[model samples]
Target chain A: MSCNLTEKVSLLVDGELSPVETRAIERHLLTCIECQQARADFLNLRQQISAYTPALNTQVQQRALASVLAKQGRAATRASAQAATPEAGRRPARIFGVPAMPFAIGMLITAAVALIVTSFVFYIVFQQAERDRQQATNTQANSSREQTATVNQPPNTNNDNSKANTFGASDEAANGKQSVDQSQQQRARGPVNSESENRQTFAANARRVRSKRPASSGTALARNAGINAPLDLHVPELLPPHEASAPRYITINATAPVAAPVRPVDAGTLAARHVEQAGLLLRAFRNARTVEQDAAADLSYEKRRARQLLYQNIVLRREAANEGNVQLASLLDSLEPILIDIANLPDQPHADDVRAIRERIGRKNLVALLEVNSTALARAYE
Target chain B: MASEDAEFTMLFQEFYPSLCRFLECLLGGRASVAQDLAQESFLQLHRTVWGTIPVGEARFWLYRVARNLALNEFRRGETRHRLFDRVVEALRPRTQTPEEEYETQERQELVLSMLKGLPEDQRTALLLREQEQLSYREIAEVLDVSESKVKTDIFRARTALRERWAQRVRAIGASVR
Candidate 1:
């Protein structure tokens, strides 16, 4: 018992012993000098410690209590002040310093709803603006193009219709310049800048037309007919003995004409070369009148070639008259004016103009003259 | 019928002076540091909301925080020792003869130096058991160890301190000869 009590003396001094153990230790201590000495030593050392361990003075203890109270008071005031103020966009309510997801979700939904409403308002406004624009377009459509042009044109121009036709030339240039081909059509439908860029642009267009157009064409008779080019008529260069090209400068007063140069046709055969040239002219006229709508531009190029042939055919037609080929001469007479009209036709000709030219050829029997005369001319080569 | 604040204030009134005295004793008589540690311990209690805590054991909680903070201060080295030394000097016994006062102070220094020299767990166990009058279970609560560990530490601290005290006295006697 003393052995057990001896080791537990610290616990005994600390009042840490169980009641049963304390009783056992205390009972043993009454008779056990060794246990008694152990108990005395533990108490004496503990008392010595207690004797020296410092205690805070009354003043220091009060100061600490006051400081704690002051801190609590300041916290209470700050929390109250925060509660009193209204928040404009306060942080969503929190629980234990974590934001409440439901409140955040509500704010997100509210923001989404507001954005959708604003977009809806903008959509309505844009749709109304579009309707107004379409209405204005219909109102303008009620007026004739002439009246609309009258309203849009500058004042004091009597020949404005003619001037718009003149401006069509420049419109072509500007149309040529627009990046999108569709933009050219839109700009053409509006008032144009008629002033600058015509001469160089027209020359450039002439060069382009020359490049793509089939080889030879007569210069168009219309002034500023940029659509036309110089003609290569392929005239046969033959004439009667007394004619200007007969290699003699003979005067009418000299009854005897100088001896005529030998006939260049190799057989003294003026009828044959005239017939061949006439056949070529007739073929040109036929090609120009070939009215395929999809190939109207090629047909237009053919017409320019025919106009050139007609200019050459005048000399050949005169030779045919000298031969007294009445059918061919009459055909040539009818074909000349038609060739000029076809040549001078707008770069994009009306279908009616082509149809009319076809009708005139049908009336004049030009196709029959070509067949008959070309057959007769081939005998010279045979 | 007490509000949370009133309950806390009641606890403070009950423990604040005792807590100051406890800190002073643990810190080797730095009265100012004792006041600070006591206040900081209560502040920690106040900062932790009342609901999550086991209010039934607020005393243990306060002492635990105060002891941890005081251990940190102790680990700060020379500063705490210097403070303790100045305090010991200030609280010098004025009524005693010069030799008697010297002997008292020398003994006090030897005991304090021994306590400080012991391992922290043993020192804390011995101090909580002896100076705070804490039970082994309560000392375990403050130090976050098992009650058995607390008992072992206290026994070890006491035995070592006693053995070293005897050794120190014998050395002093040898010197006197």
Candidate 2:
């Protein structure tokens, strides 16, 4: 019981034991002298310790304690601060307080360059397409301008009318009447003049006459007669010299000339036969004269036939004359600058070349001027 | 309510100083910290006496709370030691002889030095029995050990302290010779 009482001494001082337990330890302590002495010793020691262990107000001592406390708590303080996160996943953890700048700058520059290059390529393609479209428009405009020019051509001049007369007669001789209308239709295709059509008609007539004879005599006669006839004759002065050609030259079936020949069929008799043929043609001409005198009694019918022929010739001539004028106008339009250049100023690098250029310019200008002035002359002939 | 206030005032006046002094001793003689724990204990007691706490046992509850506070302070640091010492000095009679006071202080130093030499469990058991006056069963409850274990630990603590005190007394006698 005393052993138990000794263990209860601290509890008795603290009053931690229940009333029943306190009484038990107290009873045991009163009976046990050793336990009582042990209790007194414990009390004395505690009282003494109580004196020395208390804190007093000492500034120097408190400061020293505070320093030690701070040093001990520093690690825990820093760790707590680092662990405090308001929001997470906003930024990557910095390695050493430095950010990733190089990669981000490179990405921005690459994006900008790609945008500029794309725009530049598109600009180039669009510009090229615009230029092609402009060129096509210019070509279409030029073609329409040429068509308008053909529709607006004027009447024929004297030279054109003369050439047309030759063309119509030849057209009659070749295709007869069909070529006359066809020639007019050809005139509507472009601003061709009467002279060019006449030239073409005469050429066709000559071709027809040669083809029917199978010999060259008729061609020679027609050509020679055309030179001496009236201005209304179907003649082109620029006729081909085919009569002088080897294939077209007459082949005489004669023995020899008068001096060398001893045979009955000789060159003199052949020559006489030719003279007889000439006489026969002269008879035909006289008979036509006699018929012309007799036609004075019935003039209106004959006059009407002549006028009908003339009108047909006139129609052909007008279209043919316009065809010639169209060719000249095209040439003039191309050479317009040359003519204007010569007339406006005389400066040129080569004197002779300039003189030649001046001559051609003068001739084209003269032809254009003469044709304009000679419209009345052409009307008079018509 | 007026009567209750007067009763509360009598209880506060009676217990405040004695409870502070007892807490100082229990806290290894640190008076400033002991006073703080004592005030907290008194507040808990006040709440219970006023019917604020729902539990029936008020006195036992206050004693348990105050004892736990003093134990926790002692475990926390040596700062409580100075607080307890100062409180004990203030509580002692001023008319006591200087020699007696010195003898009492010397004995406490000797006991504390001997406690430092013992293993922690033995020192704690002896302190609870000698200073706090806890019974073997109460010491067992506080230490969370068997009552027999507390008795054995306290016996060993007393034996070691007696041997150390004898050695010190012999050394003093030899010096006198």
Candidate 3:
């Protein structure tokens, strides 16, 4: 039977034993023949196992190493190629860490939204413009009808009746009628007064007539005419030169020059006139500092004129807004407050108040805007 | 990454032939299968755990993976039959040879037969210890067993191989007579 320490001899062959254990196994091997034989047998077994497969030749070792390295190179190349595929392949580019497709989609959506909003705003603006245009056309048509009615009216003989009947016509037509009636009454008196005296009397009567008329009478008359009937005969002198020769009580055809009244002022023409007048007032007010000596007299006239223009401004502004003339409406809207300030100024305004008004006009650049809009409106009407 | 690859290449060149030899002996002297398994083990190491594993542990890791692969080959049963057929073929005599070459071939045949007779674990332990020269601890690590088990397996394998070799020699002596 083999010695029990033969297992220790196997460990000993592998040098797995401690030095003390090695010395002990060596001593035992010197004394025991069976352990010595087992040790030799174990050594022989290790030698046989080592020799069982011959060591590969250098050529074979090199070939094996080359094969492995070559495979590793190929595997590495494949891995790198895979890593590079995202940039080189079908993967989308990124912008600011966001994918290009989604970013482009976002941009397109934003553009679509902007387009919709812009189109909606334009629609609203155009709708307003159309409404204003229609209103202005209606105003022109009504004015044309009143002028046509006046042109068609028979000349009245009674002076008082003619005065009362012509009340509903435009202020220009009423003034023209009163002057013509007074001359006819003078003629009915059989030219008793001397011509120069009559001329002085007529001049005094014309001045008295103008002074008696309220500043808003023209606007009131127009408004009344829009609401009332045709009242009296039109003055021959008030008609255009071509229509002046036309017989009275003639049929007013569609092609008749009815719209060419004593003064052809539609809402657009009126707005342009208002803008021009307000620009002149603002310019005078803005430069009032240069003529401080005549400031009181000028302030009275300017304030009175501002009050009159303020009334016209409100009416024209409403008409402009109704016509969807946003540019004109907005200009008048801004001008209203300035006109109010000027109209409300004291007859003898303080220099500081005048300076403040001047500063406001300059700051708003109202003069330049008024000039530009005035030219645009005049061109539009012309 | 380049340095890691260089290190892996160095480790491969150092361990490939030894791994092939260990596998050849473990698989009962199937040289081609051993070589293939060795290459496959290295490939697996590079693919799965090259940089992740600690340095100097590749040798143990490779043997463990190769041992598992060889075990799978054994479980196939067809490989076992083929291995048996190969061992038998090594035993069959061919043309005349010099006495030294004949004896060397005879000894190799004897060793292969003795190895085939041992249990799988004992055979692996003995081959690792003798052919690969792994210590008992390393054999335990490669086999994933206790160091004491590796020692016992190696000792048992040696005892069994010695007995079988004696029996084969006696039988050969009788045939020669």
Task: Return the top candidate by lDDT.
Answer: 3
Worst 10 residues of 3 chain A by lDDT: A250-259
Better of 2 and 3 by DockQ: 3
lDDT of 1 by residue, B42-103 (tens): 97787554434644367778888888888888888536446664674464326579898788
The TM-scores, chain A only, for the candidates as listed are: 0.28, 0.18, 0.31
Name the candidate that leads on TM-score: 3
Lowest lDDT block of 10, candidate 2 chain A:
A145-154
Regions of candidate 3 where Cα sits further than 4 Å from its true position = A54-63, A80-382, B1-6, B52-55, B79-99
lDDT of each: 0.54, 0.43, 0.64
Lowest-sum lDDT 10-residue window in model 2 chain B:
B51-60
TM per candidate comes to 0.41, 0.29, 0.42
Kept native contacts, fraction for each prediction: 0.36, 0.05, 0.47
- List clashing residue pairs in candidate 1: none
Cα lDDT tens digits for candidate 2, B1-177: 333333343333333444554555455445567656766775545533443341213333555577777667657777535555555456544434889767766765565566667766776666556544446766777667897788678766665665576688799899999
- Over 4 Å off, model 2: A1-382, B1-22, B47-63, B74-93, B115-128, B131-134, B141-145
How many clashing pairs in candidate 3? 1
